[model samples]
Target: MGNFFFVRDYCSISVLPGASLTIGNNVFFNNYSSINCLDNILIGDNSIFGEGVKLYDHNHKYGFNPEFSIDKTDFKTSPIVIGKNCWIGSNTVILKGVNIGDNCVIGAGCVIHKSIPPNTIIKNGQNLIFESLQK
Candidate 1:
């Protein structure tokens, strides 16, 4: 938690040992959002996150074995950075190794697995589309 950051009720933020989670100033996280940080998660200032948003910086890694079990799999982690003045809609899931630039808007129910450029708008539908904003 950073300066002037506000997290609403029922939000769960977990920072494991040897992991880092940083939320910048004036960031608002709505209800029922969960953040699971296993590597690094940095949220810039003046960002607004809607309800039921999920952010995970790590995933299970199963080796190339035919009989791979979940309990035997290790975790692979990467960093996630959300830039300033961004708006994330409700029920969105942001995965690892994602860097979202400033002034971006992610639509509701988006499953973001790639980096987003600045001044872009992401619309959620059958397919996610990136639309650039002019000025």
Candidate 2:
């Protein structure tokens, strides 16, 4: 935690044996932002995490019968990789197995899972067709 920039209630995090979270240098995180990387999560440097940004690295597997099985929940692990100099907007949910390239802008209210290419600006309704062009 030396020479790092962070703004949060619990900047230096301490988790149990089963939980994990890793942050890089010059990273900016807003308040109430939570990251649960039970498997493997890696964040690049100079990335901005907006308010209420949630990140998960595991998904529950529910295929067993309710009465016979004693295990209530099962989890599958996936790694989340965020490239350097990225800007994650507010209230965004970054799911597992996502590899975001460098200098990308993740829009607000986005539910992301796919691997986004480098230098791409992903937006909602950025290309809208108002009228048809036909002969």
Using lDDT as the measure, which candidate wins? 1
Return the top candidate by TM-score.
1
Q: What lDDT is obtained when candidate 1 is compared to the true structure?
A: 0.94
The per-model lDDT (C-alpha) reads 0.94, 0.77
lDDT of candidate 1 over 30-117, digit per residue (tens)? 9999999989999999999999999999998765467855644468899999999999999999999999999999999999999999
lDDT over C-alpha atoms for residue 106 of model 1:
99
Native-referenced Cα lDDT, model 2: 0.77
* lDDT tens readout by residue for model 2, 1-135: 314868776433323366656667898888778787677777888999888888888777655474444334567778888888999988888898899999999987788889998787776545656876886
Which regions in candidate 1 have their CA more than 4 angstroms from the true location?
Answer: 71-73, 127-135
TM-score of each: 0.88, 0.77
